[model samples]
Target: MKIDWKNKLTSRKFISAVTGVTIAVLAIFNVDNLTTEKVTALVSAIGLLAAYIVGEGYVDANRDK
Candidate 1:
């Protein structure tokens, strides 16, 4: 089946997945600029993004009912 790349690119889940993967790769590289504090901040930011995604999904589901 053909996938809709444009729709996927505009999706929150897809954006999150890409962001998470990029973060993981950065952690793996142990970049000199990404210190402990920076990593902690990044984790917190990702957590907020995830929470927003879940909350938005919940709201959308409820609205559909």
Candidate 2:
């Protein structure tokens, strides 16, 4: 019953799904195109950074093993 949140957070599929859902919600609210684009870019950047950080942490953890 436990969720592997680390894997989820680092998953490209999961990140893309989140970005899609965010865009959908923005569209539903009739957000301006510029604002939506900005939000999307920010989300994508954050997702990439998060994945990189997690991946590096995993590598560092296993480096001495």
Candidate 3:
């Protein structure tokens, strides 16, 4: 089925799903307290953002080249 990008982006369902995954990861995978993992979480999140941007940029950059 074709996906609806506009509605998906605007929906609270997306936010709630991401929140649920984050809660599960922190609660189940985090051995230490959430406080101790705050920095690690931030860094990981940033790294993922960087990777996503780089991948997307690579595609769009080449497409326009």
Candidate 4:
């Protein structure tokens, strides 16, 4: 099966995935003395952001036409 990387690169999934990874990396490397509550909040925020990104893409794609 051929992988359509061009479309993948420009897709909402790609954006959200990259954003999530970036957030994880930032939290792991930049945060000092992390706690469970902080980690949970960070992950929850990322999930919400990712969902918003995907929902926005869907809305944009299906906007009045």
Compare the candidates by lDDT and give the number of the best one. Answer: 2
lDDT of each: 0.67, 0.95, 0.61, 0.65
lDDT, model 4, position 54:
65
Error of 2 at 62 (Å): 0.7
Model 2, CA-based lDDT = 0.95
Task: Name the regions of candidate 3 deviating beyond 4 angstroms.
Answer: 1-32
Question: Ten residues in a row with the worst lDDT in model 2?
Answer: 9-18
Off by over 4 Å in 2: none
Candidate 1 displacement at residue 11 in angstroms: 22
Model 3, 42: alpha-carbon shift in Å? 0.6
Give the per-residue lDDT digits (tens) of candidate 2, residues 1-65: 99999999879998899899999999999999999999999998899899999999999999989
Which stretches in model 1 have alpha-carbon errors above 4 Å? 1-34
Overall local distance difference test of candidate 3: 0.61
lDDT of 2 at 60: 98
Better of 3 and 4 by lDDT: 4
| RMSD to the hidden true structure, all candidates | 5.8, 1.0, 6.2, 6.1
Cα deviation of 61, candidate 4, in Å: 0.2
Q: What is the lDDT of residue 59 in candidate 1?
A: 85
Sort by lDDT, top down from the best: 2, 1, 4, 3
Model 4 scores a TM of 0.46
